[model samples]
Target: MNTLKRTLALVATLAMTATAFASCGDEKKESTPKEEPTTTATPEDTTAPEETTAEPDNGDEIDASVKTGGDTFTIAAWNHDDVPYLIAQWKGLSFDTVVEDLADNKVDGIKFIDMNVGGGQAAEKYDQLFNEGSDLDVYFCEADWALKYINDDSKTLALSKLGLGDSKFTNIYNYTDEIGKDQNGVRKGISWQAAAGGFAYRADLAEEYLGVKSPDEMDAKIGNWENFVAAAKEVSEKSSGGVALADTLGGLWQAFACGRTQPWVVDNKLVIDDFCKNFADTAKELWDCGGVTKNSQWTDEWTAAGVSGNCMGYFVSTWGFGGFFLDAAGGENGAQYGKWAVCQGPTPFYWGGTWIVVNPETDNGEEARDFIISATSDEAQMSAYAKAKPEYVNNSQVMDDLIAGDTVFNPTVSGNFKDGQNYFKKLAENAKSIDFKGLITPYDSTIKGNFADAVKENYLDGNKSWDETVEAFKDKVAESVPDLEWDD
Candidate 1:
């Protein structure tokens, strides 16, 4: 077959195969760590003024929004931050617009249904819309659960359907491409940011405790797991139990899960590799060593620890730095604003990310294509995005500019987490280390959770023996996923 025919044939096959997810009507919700947006920082930081966004003159004008008979291009998510990205990118404005405009469908000449559901409740709503054969235009999928939807051709439309080609995705991280590709290798989605993680530590804490003077010096104190533990011991002993090493158990869990080399399941049977066991042992070790604070994840206490200068640092992805870490440090105006720095912690693992997905049958195809391309592909918009925040944006070209050592840091983020240093240089290097080839599974969310539960039961609490804990975990997994095959 000729190239066009071959491409068309592939698109048709992929669309049919991937639709299995929502055929009975459901889109995938996040099974991965949820991204905390830069909006979470504070009242002032979240709403930077409109006059600040200076559009780059890179000369790539995206095609106009879909001109329909007043049809609103509906996009849904569980949060309130994503829609503003679209509107701002479209209007080429600074990070100043009110998200309420999209929420209430008040933007002129264009209509939008920026429906946001509460956390953990988006899946059911997506299913309801799909079941009712709604005209949903664009949506998002997270790293952990994206496969559930992307592997279903019948439920999703390939970006090719809107004239997008692989060329548009050339600069995105390879792992991102691996995750967003359909089973047949057709690209189905694109993530505008790369969620590479690092160690966000208090420069003051590192210096006061370990005498580590810079991010590089601090990295040596805990660059690997062994060093990390040794450093935690040092932190505990030196602080006289005044400071805890762990911000929370979940932070370590995020780092460990993504660095796995094997699948959680192999041929329908569960496989708890050495790394997972080590993760369990290590989590408990951190807890016992008084290496962690007692505050729960996302609690005000946990977040406040960073600003109050209590917890040492966190293991988080790129978004974590700009999102939670940025919030915890307080915005530029807060006390600990410029005191935080990032380095590679224990292992290089990615955490959360947002990928844009589409509805093939919607009438808003042009708008969808334009938005995706502008947000992800157009260099001009990406440059603007990088200039607005220190996210490890998916585009390498922009990242190079960001790393140029002084020019690309966003002025709006006056807190300047890295103190004008391109910390992403380390992140960009670390991004290359991730390989998700055999690591992911459809049941990742449940299996990962159960394993953590088992660890908490056996190691953390001692309520169950190791073997008993594992078996109970297996039992729970079996119940949640009836088809999960055992190793025997």
Candidate 2:
């Protein structure tokens, strides 16, 4: 057989095996947690009503690779959104036990510090914890700012210390694995979900405005940036500038910025190439032509856009279908429900994702190792969590099986899409192709935010030229990150 056929056969075999394993347990689905809020102290609905006593079946024999018997396992995160649920899956405890008891810090052998802050502010809280020499074992990190801890040897411990070698995580998506590693390629962190993204457009709007009948046609219409811009213009003209093809400038940046082929900073020098100019030009055109919405992201106006039919599409990731996306559809029985479809947009990109990392001072190495295994490596546990949490889990093999087997993750969310399409399938295609091996930098979060702000204020809003916008971006970034060198 040829190489391609062999590869396909292997994947098919793995899918079948994974499906059998995934069927081993009864899946009890729960409502996904709301997206982390910037100002909220705690996550909404941190406590769940149901009790789950059954532990995930990890086959007959257990692999106790690391030493056990630590007195307490302490986990920390910015909010109660994911850590509580993840720990519940790992400890076989009720979600309520993890959330409520952990909030009071009364769980006998576990301590979960919610921090009660946003993801961006969590770094400072973590630094304070380290300063006080608090008892911290495992912690979560966001993708953009993960390098802050991963690069600090005193903050993060290598997974190898817990016997979690690359062999154990072979089935995980490559881009996630890349983010978990540090500057020297040492494996410092790992994520449980593959947060791959695609363009979810209103099928009714596409039909009315673009004359596209299906997602395939829609994707072909906006397959690349140039084509996407043209399609947006078409939508604007057809709608008489009443509707926008893209959601917001921030959303566009989320999908557009990921296509960069060079590191933002190399050898302590900032790099600004034609990619910056192209994005500015694109944003400016869309801003002027009403091809993209002017609403700032994370506002009520953004969600209202979809409900009011003012926007045609959203660049959404796997996690979004539950929270903001559902709100955008005005809930399950809302006016716009069941009118959406997803396609691998102009480019493959990922939005927000969380990573699990161990503290170098962890006294509970065994619990940390076991938790990571259950959350990330053990196919049985991950499959169960994926179904229960309804997440696009990191393991490619498990997701492949779930998608292949036509497992419906969530009925209500699926009902939000046209014909209840299997949305994970489209996200899976993008997940496999995201290449970010040498692209991550510790200053990524600050730099990306600064650039976007500069573009919005200086180029898109103020109508500045490319060079002037570049200078404004430089000045803004210099205030935040003064160490990097740049041309005047």
Candidate 3:
């Protein structure tokens, strides 16, 4: 709470630094939209919220002001990835309900506005919606640009307004809780998934190159940046430079950046500490020694590197295993299938997460509250969703129970790993360890992405000096965010 208080106090000074930015710069793999589902089934009856009174988790009944039974409830998101499935789970639809069936933009009384845009572009679409006074009751927010709405009272509704309070969200992860709150420490949003990350590696490669047969051994081998570099060197030498210990510079930055102990900006000035230089130097070492592959992420070559045995590991989040990680193994029974495993990387980090925010002008506040509760608060629904969508749900208690129960979120993805490892268990450890409390800034997405780009282009790829790299990073930040005071 002290961190949140401190963060809120700094908002007045730092607010201007992000108000000019239009898009989320945090890079993420988005879900591909599908046309329709192959099978059609009737959506199950949904449970409606109680009409007059609501009891919060702390055993206090509050007078609910939000009215229910609106003619239509509208929800919006950039893509069809999450909202569809979330709706399915909330409605008690069959766990096997095909998401594509809801992609037609209609499911019962709910009218989904599929902006069909990238996460970065969703803000523009939402702006248009708000300007037109479109009927939007609930909307999703990416962690990066979430503050753009959370901080705007006119855009986001406080959960307390709907009779939901802290007690209802007591079981969620800490890092995610911080991101959903706005300046002054009011909860405006909540997420359903925890996008924690870890280093996923080829089990055979670790054993062959580093003499590490288990994830525990591999984790110890690269426990810190220093040890990680040493292990990379060992892998490079043993493999005759044919295989790299890591995947990409971008991947390395994702893990390393989270270790930052300071905000990107303070007092309207950009803060470029030793963390930046250290990352550049580390990335350069990997680039020069072939410790990491040159292939860019989200590309065919990136996935092909794994199949051809050119790359040993990838820094992956919970959502990735179901998507790109499968491709890296060349699909089920493919070349690299069943040879993979995951370990806690050099540091604890989270990649991408989506939050549910209510529109302040919404008429279906009760429905919004109920939907959020099902996705984020209610243990049973969250647990069902965790396994059904193969998601790493945001509720820590639910995830802990699932992990203890040895629940397999996805079979094909687990089967692709060595010994069919339950990868979510590793991510849960990371989810609990991530602490981005007072450290979050609205400009974080842009600054982090810009910093990563400068490091890759100037230092690692261009062979520029460290000072030159710093200058390049500064120049990029200046262009992206001109409001900050540059320390020359």
lDDT of all predictions: 0.64, 0.77, 0.77
TM-score of 3: 0.86
Work out the TM-score per prediction: 0.80, 0.85, 0.86
- Clashes in model 2: which pairs? none
RMSD of candidates 1 onward, in order: 13.1, 14.4, 11.9
Candidate 1, residue 21: the lDDT equals 15
Per-residue alpha-carbon lDDT of model 3 for 21-56, expressed as tens digits?
Answer: 221111121111212212111222222221223223
Q: List the residue pairs that clash in candidate 3.
A: none
Instruction: Tell me the deviation in Å of residue 182 in model 2.
Output: 0.7
What C-alpha root-mean-square deviation, in Å, does candidate 2 show against the real structure?
14.4
Model 3: residues with Cα > 4 Å off, grouped in runs: 1-69, 95-106
User: Candidates 1 and 3: which is better by lDDT?
Assistant: 3
What's model 1's TM-score?
Answer: 0.80
lDDT against true structure, model 1:
0.64
Compared with the true structure, what per-residue lDDT tens digits does model 2 show for residues 1-488?
12222112121101000000000000111011212211101111122212223223233233343345778898899999888888888878786566887787766798888899877678889999999999899999887677778877778877877778867898999888888887778888999998888999999999998899988898889878888889999999989999999998988888777776656766555567666777888888889999999997789999899999999999898988988888889999998999999998887788888999998778787788889999999999899888887788999999999999989999999999998789999889888887767777766666677788889998878878777787777665555655554432
